[model samples]
Target: MDTKRIFRDFNHCKFLVFTCLLPAELFVSLYLDSVINWSLWLVLLPIWTLKVLVIAGALVGTIVWCHKPFRRNEADGFTDFKAMLITVGIQVLLLLFELLLCNKIESNSPISWILVFTPMYLVSTLSIGACIWGYKNARSTELESLISLNTLLFVFVSLKLHNVIHWNWSVIFIPLWIIMCLPTIVVLHHLWTLAFLRSNFHGVDKQSLVLDTIMWIAIDVPLLTFEILLASRLDQQNDISWVNIFIPLHISLLGLIWSTFGRKGGNTWWFGLREDFCTIFLRICPFMRLYGNVECKEREGGDGSEIMMMPVVTQVVCKSPSKCEPVVAVTHIATPD
Candidate 1:
């Protein structure tokens, strides 16, 4: 397979890289906000330096992973222009707001207010514009992805602006955290489904609509549970009751539903037991690797008969017009079946 050609598929690679980096970025931000006291930066220069270094490393890693080696033609023209404009506009607003919050200039002054408020206005406008673009160009998934990123960024900035004005940590942080998690969860779901479908269906197996339904539930139930749990925990200092009692019960119920209906094979279920099994295996295989062995294999006969064999394994493969890309194919042979 041509690595360059594979990389040229910017939509797939970009989304994957974005999904991976977002979690890391959120964690780093959390550390910076919670652990590092901004006032002590002068006294604890070394600690501040180390924190900056860590953040820099994460930023570099994200860039390396997500950066396209060769720019796609689709990425050029108006898309590039629009993305650049939005990014630049965001930065400008960020700077202005930071200045206002720090009280570098008197708030009573018209200039200060304008500086503080300009970014908020721009972000809102850009968000609406991006949404319109997304609606108009629904066919271009790449464009849609770009719009999604921009919209999310706008939300982040808007939340930040709210924080600056209200000066309430709980109100500000909780909403911001939820906003960040939204994109993270969506991206994860897409990647998970992409992987699951590629491995199970080979190409688009429209006939196996049942399998697709199972795949969705299998991926979503656990993911939604984990997300709710995580968000609840983050907001625990504000309200522990939800995280401690209701959330856990909700997760248990979701798990039970998934285990019962998710595994049952039929058009009633949307996808089959085989896919549910694959989804469950995919979810747990990483932790399982710490203990023992698992394997999955597909054997093809000349007569178009195919056999999928497993020894506790999970795999996802993407098929293109010219080539089939193995996204995740982990195998272990303890006693070959």
Candidate 2:
């Protein structure tokens, strides 16, 4: 798993933090704030912890790099350092936004919604610039789409909150609805394939297909349900409790947490970072080995030393003494020396 490089790589550490802490934080904060009436600061401690750690690390890295730049890889080091500063800047902006939001929610602060959302507006503006630059450089445009939609959603929400627009909560959430339907469409396609095209697959392939389809449903269904419930509650369309509306969100967060630990801890399409914390964690707590068999198989395949310890036996067919019957006998056994 290259445990040595896991912590050294910035992206790996970022992935590890998000995968382990983010979902759990969401669930905990939502539950505590909605049910227990906890202070926003206490409920958001996890986020604060993560932000502090990230900012501290970035500061330390920047200082170290400035003091003694990498002689052999100076260009890469400078580039990474620049990226780290940019990332920390973004985090600081987000923290500011959160502070404004918390103040508004808790103390009934008189900050205008537009003023509170200034950080986001800046981010979106930068994102638009990034999208343009990326397009010119033949890079991905996915971020542009997300930023655009989120900007629209934010504007709609701000208007709704300020009574500037007399739009229903459901109408204000059209961007989210659009986003959710994209994945729902994907899941529906998988279901259709599973129902009608099942004959074309077999064995492990079929099992994998089914598992993937199930995972998609497990994540998407809860998210869709939660969004619908939240909108309904906001619009006073239903008397469902806040806790009830968040139950589906809790489920989805749990699924995300499970997926983080279940899958091989490495770079992926969704999370392009690698860390061995999950592997180490599973080993330390033996009773929590939900995917033990898979881990064992991965370990066996990943290293040749483990495979060399097994004994090899060869079977030979020999004729029996009295009857014209063939008997099987072990001819040789090869063991590790």
Candidate 3:
């Protein structure tokens, strides 16, 4: 009903920019790739095809951002459902077309291309599926907050699942399937944050959902990385050692991350750290800030006389036992005047 807010929330004109890019990219890929035929379309056309996937992702992202429910913070969760379903349906058709093309090419085509492109294809496809499951019938996405910040990162890495499969390790699919499924954990994490924010969370749910997320991610990263790396080595015809140096090194680094972020009665757990020089190494360094250190700050405007200071994620050090302050809440983000 509020068209202005909808456009504003979706960021007027931005969607057009991305949507416009698709045609331009298509023109270039089609015309420049020496015509559009089954050869280029059905087979993996290398970077050109990858670029198309990127474009598809961008287009999907654009649609997601502009979905009316997302713009209005509606909880129906059905906002982009139909669109995403159609997108996925189309991908399925393409997969069928690809299979036909495969048979046309060779009996035992190297399966690497199929493995490589499928996950991203799903990512660019299934992203708009609305992640709903009978929660109050309908809910706004932001309210539901049913997505983890780590979803994209984890999904991207899990794309390498095909690598493990290509290694001829049939048993690896079991773990591979689990790692790929971790995005659902991210969705649950988002939903968990929403419950915590809305005061809807109880002890049972917290331990069940939050603890589950922490455990799954804690296990997934190391396992997937080791598998992918081992597979890559095998692919490269290099000898793999039982004592994989990378596994321990990665574990140590992530262990440090968990210690800092997981226990999180700290600033880093709230506002993330920026990759600044020397300041991280020297804690006392003056004016050190993470990138979003001072983001979405609240302010009194219209009078145009306020002197707003640079927003920084200041440390909330609890110097006294009895004076513990609460972590910053999402409600703290300022609304427009």
Candidate 4:
């Protein structure tokens, strides 16, 4: 067999299979331990250790595969290593936290903070890092699309975990997470769109934006519905009432509306629509008065730009024409002009 063919086979067979199976296995172990009340270390530890070993083996395999005397420049040493390390590190951290710590605690342990918090932190960090690198290095629409989807998954997963562990049940956080997701999501959308648009113009035969739009709506609508349903079901334990349903309902409706109308022409309708509605609703909805004036702005430079630009201020009032309240801003300066 040829060396290149051998490398390709190893990547497909060993690395890919290990990467996919490790997560599935870990999640299965977690479900058994948490929801099913199975033994933790006895059933999961060996598998978890194997996952680590497989990942290590994959990393080593990838290195070996890249090593060729004649194909020195073919290897992206630091970049490939960094990417693999970050990804593997996050998976390992998640396994340790969800499998080891989450199971061990009869009650939430403050000292076990490392296991609880580290996964979210590391996953978020790696995701943001990968997104930044992908934005810079990813040369194809398919790769960029995959990265974008992964980034959204990361955000959703991280936020979901945070809410499950730390956040209280409130409609407030639903909008808050959506707000948090806006900028990164927008950037991802823009990249995916631009890549395809450019490909189309260049006659590279990319996927259709219309089809992409439809596919996005199709996937998002069902997923959002499921999320709302899950949220509603979870909320039943706490506040099983119409008011409790409002959050998830609003979330689902807004998501559908946004996907249909807001995301029309591949531009976000959230900020503008929110502003218009808030402007109108503020007159009728007395609670809207509590929100004060929110001004979204974007910052230049740093990894902060990669995830979403940080909200400079949360709550403040607009005193005058020159004065504006601080809000979460999605700046697209880093995006190609």
Using all chains and alpha carbons, the TM-scores for the candidates as numbered come to: 0.34, 0.65, 0.23, 0.41
Consecutive 10-residue window with the lowest summed lDDT within model 2: 266-275
Give the alpha carbon lDDT tens digit for every residue of 77-167 in model 2: 4434444554566667778888888898889888888788888787666667656755665444453456655887887887777778998
Which residue pairs clash within candidate 4? 297-329
**Of models 3 and 4, which has the larger lDDT?**
4
Better of 3 and 4 by TM-score: 4
Looking at model 2, the pairs that clash are none
By lDDT, rank the candidates, best first: 2, 4, 1, 3
Q: Among these predicted structures, which one has the highest TM-score?
A: 2
- List per-prediction Cα lDDT, in the order shown: 0.40, 0.59, 0.40, 0.44
* lDDT comparing candidate 1 with the true structure: 0.40
Candidate 4 differs from the real structure by a C-alpha RMSD in angstroms, to one decimal, of: 23.8
Per-residue lDDT of model 1, residues 116-144, tens digit only: 55555565566556567645743223323
By TM-score, is 1 or 4 better? 4
The best candidate in terms of lDDT = 2
Candidate 3 displacement at residue 23 in angstroms: 39
C-alpha-based local distance difference test score of model 2: 0.59
Clashes of each: 5, 0, 7, 1
